[model samples]
Target: MVDADASPPQAGEPISEQEALRRLRQSEDSSQQYYGAWWLGRMRSQHPEAVPLLQQALRQRRPRDSGDGVEENAVARNAARALGKLAPAAQTAIPDLLDTLQDADDGLREAAARALGQLAASEAIEALCEKLASGPAGAGAQQANSPRLVEPCEALLEALGDIGVNEPRVLAVVKPFLEHERPLIRSAAARTLLQLSGEARWGELLVDLLDHPQLQVRRAALMDLGAAGWRPGFQAIAATLAENSLKLMALRGLVEQGNGDPGDEALLACMDALL
Candidate 1:
């Protein structure tokens, strides 16, 4: 929770790179630390020197609740994310970030995976695949943002895709997630598959998933279809345009495929039905 009033400076406001770096090193409060990390990434993170500072920030941990384990270190997580923005410049941090994959904090693990992908550190692919297959480290925690902690499998899947690793074993780990009971997981799996495979069949698979009983699953399918610019199932997608919970997702898919023309009688009919 960064309080806007207390935050260092808004995005457009001018701040010196040296000052940002100084704040990043000097800030003791988590919120301030997060703000500093963000500014550093946005301003001059590409500089090689930013890597060590960001790594040090990631090493700082907040007190943990022994009863219900959750890493309360927003600062470290933010720093990890900052390192990700640095990309190849942060390549030196790969080994340390790799170790972070086993951290008990789901958010930290997600951040580390994101950094690895950004760096395109192919060496970490096998370790990430193993984590995806075994499931993310630590039990789920009730974070303010979500009742469920960040799901590491999805993060790992996305990371692998970002790094352009399309190995059969990687595919094998991700394939099973498509049938996961949770729609969010199913959605992440679907998106990652499309990103890695770029196969029309995967898009078609998402189209089929539009018929799933859960609105969450249907939403995920529609979103992926839009991303792929898939047109084969516009009819089924149009039908969902009338569903309150799925309406936006369905419309987004139609729009992406340029199916929103007023002259298209079927699409107009679907839109009219919504009225």
Candidate 2:
């Protein structure tokens, strides 16, 4: 008799590892619903039985309904995340993950996108770019029916920065967000541009953000510009110092980027007063 709670056998039994793998492959459940997929992914080394099962699970369609409701979807997401741990070796899973990017469920889509980035799958760059181009703005004011979508998009954007893929596409996708009505989106966009600024395309864009009406936006842009070695951004930083609350950040930006000359001394005095 099979023990209900016994960990699925690690070796031969009535169900041959190969046959069990085939069953998992043929299962109708979406890749996202199978908890066993993640387990198999992690055990690929200790248990040779794991690899084929994970690959099969990755090929399965997303679940229409997870038994546990919210937690059900976590199964698929964990599977992708596990595959990410398998990374370059898990390259075969990239296409399936990319397909998940099209899922209507924002969280699932975001998870899959982030996993692709983790895998550093260059093939995903164009699809990620397209998603960013047409996706809803991350700003709080955009009125999304699903509030959770924003973080996933933000995560996908950040992952692009980490993988160093799609420089032009990333800039193009993020440019529109710089004008977003929500400060959160604006901040996220500014930060991403800062991370990718070594390419120089973001320099002009960061400088422009100095003029944003929100003080927070201006502050974030200042920090990014200063870090990127954009000396020209100092003038805007100096102007911001007139606001006592903003003086410290302005002073920091200056000190970090300035040439340490007479202009910097004057700015230091102004910052002292606000301190």
Candidate 3:
């Protein structure tokens, strides 16, 4: 009974799965289509058709003005993100998502990398490595470009970590990133290195990053430690100067990784005073 032409609800307004799919597949308006895809993924749509429809949207990488040089395909990027969220269900979309890693669009590439990571598409290890090195010229390229020291896709580091590719070559490529100009990238390298190698040095570096001057950097380090579930950084994460909610999220992430429990001193201290 709902009219497709109805003015869309507020950006974050809740809508049924069917309505979301309707907007994504049937709407003529680009914003509607984008929002619809976003809603499906954000709501974690359980529709049997969600995967196929999102796969279809994934190929419509039509270029749109990004104000920056990067031509973005917002719809396709959103689809990629949604597919990642629907992983195991979207497992069949792995090849399609893998193809997107070579995309010219940085945003799409980043989204695809994140999706592949969540999927843990081990087959994607080499392709991800190739793209990761594209930022410069493999190891040398990282800081080679002035003003942009890290790989263009910072998420690539996390995706690699998430995928847990621990080959020596992979370690060699990721290690160089630790010295990149950006502290966030450094921390991501730290996380990847830590996960793959289980090295105490990398975890120690992450703990140091918790003290980074930038708020976002500190936040990134917080989550990275949580993702790493690096037990050594537990107290530092609790003590780091980030928002209380962010700190709690990191602690909970660590706990979920089996690093500790709510009764643990760090989580206990953080919960009592959410700074």
Per-prediction TM-score, please?
0.67, 0.52, 0.85
Ranking of all predicted structures according to lDDT, beginning with the best and ending with the worst: 3, 1, 2
Best candidate (score: lDDT): 3
Q: How accurate locally, in lDDT, is each candidate?
A: 0.66, 0.57, 0.75
Clashes of each: 0, 1, 1
Return the lDDT, model 1, position 66.
61
Q: What's the lDDT for residue 130 in model 3?
A: 77
Q: How many collisions between residues are there in candidate 1?
A: 0
Q: Write the per-residue lDDT of candidate 3 for residues 1-275, one digit (tens) a residue.
A: 01112233354667789888888887467677788878877777889989898898898885556575533377788888888888689888889888888776656777888888888888888887876664434532544435443334467777888899799878877877787766877888898898888888998998888888888889988888788777667678878998878777777767676353334675666656764
Model 2 weakest lDDT span, ten residues long: 1-10
Please give, for residues 225-266, the per-residue lDDT of candidate 1 as tens digits: 654445555666766523543554455545554432333466
- Score residue 3 of candidate 1 by CA lDDT: 12
What C-alpha RMSD separates each model from the true structure?
Answer: 7.1, 12.2, 5.9
